[model samples]
Target: MFIREITHWFARRSFQNRIFLLILFTSTIVMLAITWYLTDITKERLHYQVGQRALIQAMQISAMPELVEAVEAHDLPRIKALIDPMRSFSDATYITVGNEKGQRLYHVNPNEIGKYMEGGDSDDALYNAKSYVSVRKGSLGSSLRGKSPIQDSTGKVIGIVSVGYTLEQLESWLNLQISSLLFPMALLLLVLLYCARRFSLHIKKQMLNMEPQQLSQLLIQQSVLFESVFEGLIAIDSQHRITAINQTARRLLNLSQPESELIGYAIHHIVLPEAFFYDAPQKNKKDEIVTFNQMKVIASRMAVIIDNQPQGWVISFRNKDDINTLSLQLSQVRQYADNLRAVQHEHRNLISTIAGLLFLKRYDNALALIQQQSESHQKVLDFISHNFRDHHLAGLLIGKYYRAKELGLELIFDPSSFVEHLPSSLSHNEWISIVGNLLDNAYNTTLLNREGSRQIECLINSEGNEVIIEVADQGCGIDENIRQHIFERGVTTHNNGDHGIGLWLVHSYVKQANGDIIVDNNNPFGTIFTLYIPFTREE
Candidate 1:
C-alpha cells in the first residue's frame, strides 16, 4: 500500500518534476551499487595479492639451503636468521618455521619457537609436500596465511615455511583502495545529476511546464471542437498539401467519398486560387468568395506560425447558401424599416395639412382631401396586393412604393403588371434580389435626371414557368461605349468612388438562374432593362 501510494503521488507531479526525481533516484541507485561492487572487488583482489606475495616468500625461504641445513641440524637460531630477511621483504605480519611433526622450529615471536604450530595449513605443506594458502586465526589474530614445503634431498618434506598478513593490516590497504574509488565515482555521480537537472529544465520549458495528463486532456478537447464546428476548416502545410480537414470541410470541398480524401492532396488540385496559399508576408485574408463545384463559399485564411516562422496555413469557410439566407433576412428588415419611416413622414405631413384645414373651419375641404388621399392610397395598395398574390412580393412592392415617394420620385407600376402564385423554384430571397436591386438602380439613376423626369416605371408578369420583369427610368441614358461593360462590377458613372456592383449582381443572379437580361439604351429618354428568369430551378 505504501509503494502504491508513492507511485500515485509521483504520477501526479508535473513532467519536469517527475523527470528530475526519476533521474536522481536511478543515478543514486546505480552509483551506490557501483560503489558496493567496487569495494567488494577491491577487498578480494587485495586479499589475493597479499596471499600470492606471501606464498612466493614462503617458497623462497623453504628452498633456502641455510634453512634446510639448520632444520637438519636442528639449529633454530640459524633458521630464524635465514628466514628473517625474506619475511621482512614480503611484508607479512608473522613468519614461522615448523618441523614435520608440527613443532615450531623458528618463530618471529621467540616464545613460540620449539612449540607446536596450531594451524592445519602448515601441516599440509610439510606432510603432503604441497603449497597452501588460507585465512585462519593465529598468534597475530585473524590473518591470510600461506605455507610452502621444506623438502630434503630425497624430495620428502622436512618442514614448513609460513607467512601471514593480519586482518588489521589488510583492512588498512582496503580502506585506501575504497577512498580512491569513491572519490572519482562520487564526482562522476555529481556531474551526472547536474546534467540530468539541466536536461529536465529544458524539457520542462519545451512542454510549457504542463503535466502529461493536462496536455492530453487539452488535445482531446481541441479535437472534439475541431470536428464539431459548423464552419468548414482545413489546414495546409508549407508545400500546399492538405494536412488536416474537418468533416464539414470534407463535405464543402466535395470530398465525401472514401477515395476523395483530401489529406496529402495538393491545394492547387482543389481549385482554390494559388494566391490564397502563398507563403510570402503571412497576411490573413477574410471573407473571400471562391467558387468550387459550382458552389460559392466565403473563405478566410490565416498562416500558422511557429517559432516566428510560417509553418502552414489554416482556412475556414461557410457555405454561401447560409450567407445569402442571412443577407436576405437583413435586407427584408431594412426594407421594412425604410418603408415604415417613409409612411411615418408622409402621415405626419398629411395630418398637419388636415389639422390646418380643420382649424380654419374648412371642414368640408379637410374631409374631401382626406377621402381623396385615402382612396388613392387604397387603390394602389389594393391593385398591388390583388395582382401580386405572394405576400413577400406584395410587401416588397409596397416598401418600394413608399421608398420612392420618400425621395420625391414618382414610382409607377405598368398597367399590364401582374404576377400570381409563383412556383417554389423562384425563392423569395431571389425575388428580393432581382426586384430590389433593379428598383434601387432605377431610383438612383432617376435621381440624376431633371425634376420633371424623376420617375421610375416597373413592370412584372408571369408566363408558363417563366417571369418577365422590366424597370425603366427617365434618367440620362447610358453611353454606347459604357454599355459594353456596364453590367461588369466596378464600372459606374457615379464619381463618388462607389462601385457599380448592383448591375453586376443582377447580371450574375440572372445568369446563375439560367435567365436572360437585355439592356435597351437606344431611346433618347432613358435606359430600360428587361429581364426574363425561368421558374425551373437549376439542378
Candidate 2:
C-alpha cells in the first residue's frame, strides 16, 4: 500500500521533475553505499595498523637486555628507570611489566607497580610464552593491548610486557579519517545532482515542455483534423517516403490500398509530378494544375519546417473535374445574366425606333419593323431549341449569340448544325468549357479585325460516330512561327495576359475526350479551329 501511494505521487509530477527526482534518488543511494563501504575499509585498515603498532612495541620492550636483566634480578628501581623514560616518549595509552605470577613489576602509573595486572588475559603470554594482541577490560577501561612474555637466558618466562590503546582513542582516530572523506564525497554528490538536473531540463525542452499525456492528446487531435479535411492531403518525409495520407487522397488518386499499407512507400510510387518532390520551391505553391495517376488535379504544396530547418512536405489537392464543374455552373449563371442584359438593351433600341415611327404616324413601317425583329429572334431560338437536346449547351449558344451581337460581331450558326445529345465519353461541364471557350475566342478574334468582315461562324454536329465542332473567325490569321504551338498554354496572339487560357482549356478538354483539333488559315485573312471528339453510346 505504501509503494502504491509513492508510485501514484511520482506519476503525477511533470516529466522533468520525475526525471530529476529519479536521478537524484539513485545517485544519492549510490553515494551513500560507496561512503559506507569506504568507511568500513578505512576503519578495518586503521584497526589493523594500530594493532600491529602495539604488538611491535611490546616485542621491542620485551627484547630489551636491560628490561630482561631487571626482570630476572627483580630490580624494581632498574626496571622503573628503563620503562619510565620509554612510556613518557611512547604514544601508547599505557605500558606495564608484570611477573609470571601476574604481579605487576613496573607500570606507567607508579601506584599500580606493586599490584597485579588488572586483565586476566596475561595467562597466554606467561604460560605459553606467546606474543599476541587482545581486547580486554583493564583498570584504565576496555582497551586493545598487545602482550609479549619476557624470558631470561635459561628461556624461563619471568615477566610480561603489554602495550595498549584504549577503545575511546581508536574511535576518535576512526572518526577523524571518516570526516576527511565525507567532505569530498559530499561535494561529488552535489556535482552529480547538478548534472542530473541539467540533463533532465534539456530532455524536457526537447519535448516542448509537454507531458506524455498532452502529446498523445495532441496526436489524436491532429489525426482527427487530418482525416476530416475535404481536400486530399499527403505528407512525405525528407527521404520522400510517405508518412501520412488521408482517405481523400487515396480516393482522389484512385488508390485502393489502406493508409497503413501506403505509408512508408516512396512518394514516387504514386506517380505525382516531380515538381512536388524534387528541388521544391522555397515559397509555397498553391492552386497548381498537376497530373496524378493520369487524372488532373488542382494541387498545393508547402514545406514542413521546424527549428529553421526543412523537415518534409505536405501536399493538398482536389480533382480538377470537381473544380471545373463548379466553375462551369458559375459561368453559366453569369452568361445567362449577360444574355438578359444584351436582350434588354436590344429591346430598348427597338422600342425607341417603334415609338418614333408611331409618333410620325408611320404605323405600317412600325408594324413591319416589329414583325421583322420578332421573326429574326424567333428563328434563332427555334433552331437552337429544336436541334440541341442538351439545355446547357443550347443556352450557352444562345448567350454567346447575344454576347457577340453586343460586341458588334455577327455570330452565325450553320443551318445544318445538329446535336441530338451530349457525348457520353465527356462530362457536360467539359463540353461546356470546350464550346464556350471556342465561341469566346472566336468572338474576341473577330472583333480584332476591324478592317475585315466581323463575322464568326459556329457548327456543331453529333449525328455521326464522332462529334464535330468548328468555329471560324474573320481575323488576323495565326502567326507562321506560332501556329504549331497555338493551342499550348501561355501562347496567345492577343496582347492581354488572360487571353491564353481559353484556347488551352479548349485543347485540354478535347484531348481528355480523345479528340483531335485542327487549326487552319481561313480564306481572306482568318483562322479556323475544328475539333472532332469520338463518342460511345451508353447501353
Structural similarity to truth (TM-score) of each candidate: 0.56, 0.57
Candidate with best TM-score: 2
lDDT of 2 at 191: 99
lDDT tens per residue, model 1, 472-494: 98777788888888877677766
Quality of model 2 by C-alpha lDDT: 0.88
TM-score of 2: 0.57
RMSD of each: 10.9, 9.2
Q: Please list the residue runs of candidate 1 whose C-alpha ends up more than 4 Å from where it truly belongs after superposition.
A: 1-15, 234-245, 254-306, 309-315, 324-539
Candidate 2, poorest ten consecutive residues by summed lDDT: 273-282
Worst window of 10 by summed lDDT in candidate 1: 272-281
Please give, for residues 372-456, the per-residue lDDT of candidate 2 as tens digits: 9999999999999999888989988888888887888888999989999877767787788889999888877877887779889
Instruction: For candidate 1, list the clashing residue pairs, or say none.
Output: none
